[model samples]
Target: MPDPNSFLYNNMIKGFVDIGSYEDALTFYFQMLNNVYNRCNPNNFTFPFVLKACSKLTAFEEGKVVHGQVLKLGFSSDVYVETSLVDMYGSCREVVYSKLLFDRMCKRDVVAWNAILASYTQCGVMECAKGLFEEMPVRNVSSWTTMIGGYIQIGDSKEALECFYKMQKHGMKPDKLTIMTVLSAVADLGSLEIGKRVHEYMDTNKIEIDGYVGTALIDMYSKCGNIQKARKVFDGIRSKNISCYNAMISCFGIHGLGDEALRVFREVERTRIGVDDVTMIAVLTACSHSGLVDMGCEIFNLMRKDYGIEPKMEHYGCMVDLLGREGRLDEAMGLIESIEPDIVLLGTLAFACRIHGNVELGEELARRMSELDPTNSGLLVLKSNLYAVEGRWKEAAGVRRLMMDKGIRKKPGTSWIEINNVVHEFVAGDASHSHSKKIYSKLLELSERMKLCIPTTQRCQV
Candidate 1:
């Protein structure tokens, strides 16, 4: 006990960290710091692990105490200690303090740069994140990935992809993390072609396709309108985890493949795999889309009873939408009344009322919608349309006038045509183009042709 070795203390901390038991490491660290025998080697090894544990536990006060000890022990200027401090503060949501420590570092390594960049990203300060990215003297795989990930988190898929391209141009081979970020961009873009190329790269480079990466691929392909390929990818994953199943089921449900999605859900349930809210919402939405009333009812009942999954607002919205689609206006209203009426739920009610020509309910829902989102042009349009359908021409015109006064213009009606791999968009009454006359003539002819193909019931209704 007279000369407690620093190596033994370091090894103990390392073992605790390796086991992902940060609290244990912190406990041992403080014990060593207080021990008289360990006083001589105070600067040796404990601070880094203590900082990590503090970060992991979000022990901000304890972390500050350790920071004092780190400075007193003369390890304050150490690169590793500085980086840990930056990460700890960042994780504790003290980005400003993390940045202060980062700015004080005499020499910043890749880990330090990555830590600060991640802090900015997580804090949702994208401009500052970009500034830090630009200031990095030497960027590594983690730096590039963190930059791209920040963009992704902010829903800037285009900028994220641009960053990915820049990373590739710098001659740095992207690792699995980079691929995961790019896949996210591709998923948002709904591009099966780019997704396939990424899959090819992963396969050719022997990149291990774990659950996270594999699920991402399935999600990308399915969202891009290739559910079959998504299924194939799902099957190819050797270590199929619950997340993989959730991704596939979500994609299938979203794509209107209700039967296929239900099959997958049943299979997952058979395996005793747990279904979280994401899985439940996805499945319920699929059932709603397909008008599977009985199936939806059974699933909703089972979720609350057997699975014990509490129905969230989204689930309630899906149920309302399902009932509304089937012309069960009373049932849909009952469902909405069962829960607090949020914007989505009210919106669904408005849509159903419009479909059933219930002008009263539509007006009520419109009033609530205006309160929830006063300036939403779509809600105003729905309300105006309901008035128009009820032959309340004066009311409809008044609604439009109110919209104008509020400076909320109805969204322009536009259609897209892909001709020779180039997408061309046309707005209503658009006539500035040289081919305007020809475009109008073709659209008129197509409208006539589409009318001929309409079903008897729809033609009668029209």
Candidate 2:
């Protein structure tokens, strides 16, 4: 072949990138750099495409070299090139460098702002992302979605909802991705009312209930204890995919409807849909809860033999739970020893031993568990409770003493109730709420009413 010009090389690189052949794009880039005949210099278009290939390939070192080349070629100030650089560093998990590049930019369009915003969001730096978001003079759907997604990624579902509402207040219409992300946040928060409003909005706006959004809605309703609504949504979906089926099955499991869950599984098996590990886990959990040991075993074998889905630790734990609940302690123990030991599995067995009054086995498992996780206060509490139930007062006292000496204290249980879209949290024995006095007065009134209702001869001691 003859010496190729920059135009020819640029076109070749762009074509490879457009076709998703990232390796070939990078290869052509290097070829252009090392070609003795042409010595083709990369233009602005060439740099972004190459940087994109670097981002996709996660070739950080190569990306830096390209950065240096961009500086040497005096295209460092190009907004497109700079945006690509920010994206590459962000994809490589180098948020600090991405930020530095972003800060140096003299002029930034929405694209550049979104790129940097995503970088901070991906790195779990919500504060910086929020700061940038507030400072951005112009915002788009991607910007809002990125911020909302960042909040969700960090388990701040409430904040995600807040951001979504704020976006609405700004007159920004949520796109499909935004709605899907917000629905996920709603599910995590169990904000059933808010989820219903979102569903209403989707209906009002005529947004298509695609597979992804439908699955999210199913999850939200199921987790919020509205299984009937979840089933309605499931039925409404015309084209049910495997994910849709998985969500419905999981809903039945969570509600302890083992028969319904198994029924759904059988239906899926009859269809062309394939069951994966998640599907099997849900089935096993349902079986465990309902004491369907034989069914659980059959499904567990089918998972491995027919579906080619390997049992993970969660699957084994479910099986152990099933066997242990049935008073088949020996089988449970055998299963535990056959698989790799996990804290959850051991804890389940230890609890089972206590329930069955198998003090000797409980003691052995407790010892092993302490060795595995010495700092777990729950385990110590369980051990003490076990000893106390068996009338081993001295051993129970010793366990308490050890806990005190180690300064290990169990976390106080907390519960939350949401009303009018505001979540109120209460800790056990807490009186910190503003309405605590009113709450206590109401409780005392109820107690008095209960006392009056009971006859003196039948009255029980407090």
lDDT of each: 0.84, 0.90
Q: Write the per-residue lDDT of candidate 2 for residues 1-462, one digit (tens) a residue.
A: 587888999999999999999999999999998886666888898999999999899899999999999999999999999999999999898999998999999989999999999888988999989999999999999999999999999989989999999999999999889999999998887878999999999999988887788898999899888999998998898888888888988999878899999999998899968998888888888888887899998888788789988888888888888888888889889988998888889999889888888888888888889899998998999899899878898999999999999899988898777788877778888999999999899999999999899988767533
TM-score, every prediction: 0.78, 0.79
Provide the lDDT at 426 for model 1: 71
Model 2 residue 448 lDDT score: 95
TM-score of 2: 0.79
- Cα RMSD, each candidate: 5.3, 5.5
* Model 2 lDDT on a 0 to 1 scale: 0.90
Q: Model 2, 180: alpha-carbon shift in Å?
A: 1.9
